[model samples]
Target: MLYYRQHFLHISNEGFIEIPRYIQTYLPHHLRVLIGQLQVSSHQLEIERGLSRGVPREERWCPICHTEVESEEHFVIGCPSYLDLRAEFQIEESLQLCMTMGDQWHLGRFLRATYERRERSLQLTHQTRVSTEQTITEFFQRVELHQRGPSIGLTLHQAAAQRARRRSRMVGYRRPQLYQEDISRINTTYNCMMEQRRTTTP
Candidate 1:
């Protein structure tokens, strides 16, 4: 129990606290499997009378930046790229200066922000897709109305009329509104990044 608590603290202090619960569950399962595999391999080698006794502990790779010497600090928050983002957020100053402690806080903030942006982008894309569906619906409705033959106009006149109708509807299309929302979202994100940078430090 003490080991588990210490392990959990170490992991959490490295900024794993904010990770979604499901992901955290996978960490323990994976760690158990890894240890079990290593132990079995070591026992096999011992039976074969090899020189080596057990599998050695190796350095972990940083999932975020893919650095070679991926310590908890490096993997979670010490990467230069993340530091750059923190710089933009103006929150670097408040970050834990000690590589270990600071990275824990930085990692939590960085991951949370990243997840939020991705979620927002996904929502925007979904809304855009819906808007496109609506536009297609509106276009077909216009076409159906035209086929009802209000006037026996020339080919050029019909083409021009269709174009005009489409344009008028597009001016008020949901896509445009969505685009505006996207612009605001991007601007807000940029501002947040800048604000954090100004506020924080390595």
Candidate 2:
């Protein structure tokens, strides 16, 4: 709350806020996810995440900039790497307006492109099986599948297999709960016997 106010010009103070409209209007899932991440400053950018990972405040500077911390403001507007990207996206003004009130679809596309470049630049050190873009693609694939009636795209056998899986999950009793109270009682009895043995010993 205090943090956002410090960095941002517009911070919603209401009890419940609206999900940004561009998310629904935007067709690209990767872009949408990137936009949301950028808005919340929860993306791979150092910002505060580096602090949690034991990075010193001064050392958490942008890998690209090596001047200031990799905060949302720095990544979005201050970094030299994204100078061309900022012009491409028309993000020349306030960071708050560019992110919050600006054309989100355009901004989302910019973020997606920027993130890809960022990923590429950091690939030597930050390698992973699943990239942010891949996760977004897979997420939308599942969502589209569900929206199109779970088994719509599948063949007859695939549909049957899907149903079988659903049935198995729905009907399973799962692992029975191991009542922890029984273990507690056993430990108490053992401790009592051990105490008695010590007392009765010569």
Best by TM-score: 2
Which window of 10 residues has the lowest lDDT sum in candidate 1? Answer: 42-51
Q: How accurate is candidate 1 locally (lDDT)?
A: 0.44
Candidate 2: regions farther than 4 A off = 1-21, 124-202
Candidate 1 to truth, TM: 0.26
Q: Choose the strongest candidate by lDDT.
A: 2
* lDDT values for all models: 0.44, 0.71
Instruction: Give a tens-digit lDDT track for model 2, residues 1-202.
Output: 3445454433367855445556647557877777666666667788777967998877888876688899877887888888899899888477677755788777887788788888788874454434654554455344554465453245445556888887444565586665799889989999999999999999
Evaluated at residue 73, the lDDT of candidate 1 is 30
Off by over 4 Å in 1: 1-102, 142-202
Error of 1 at 15 (Å): 24
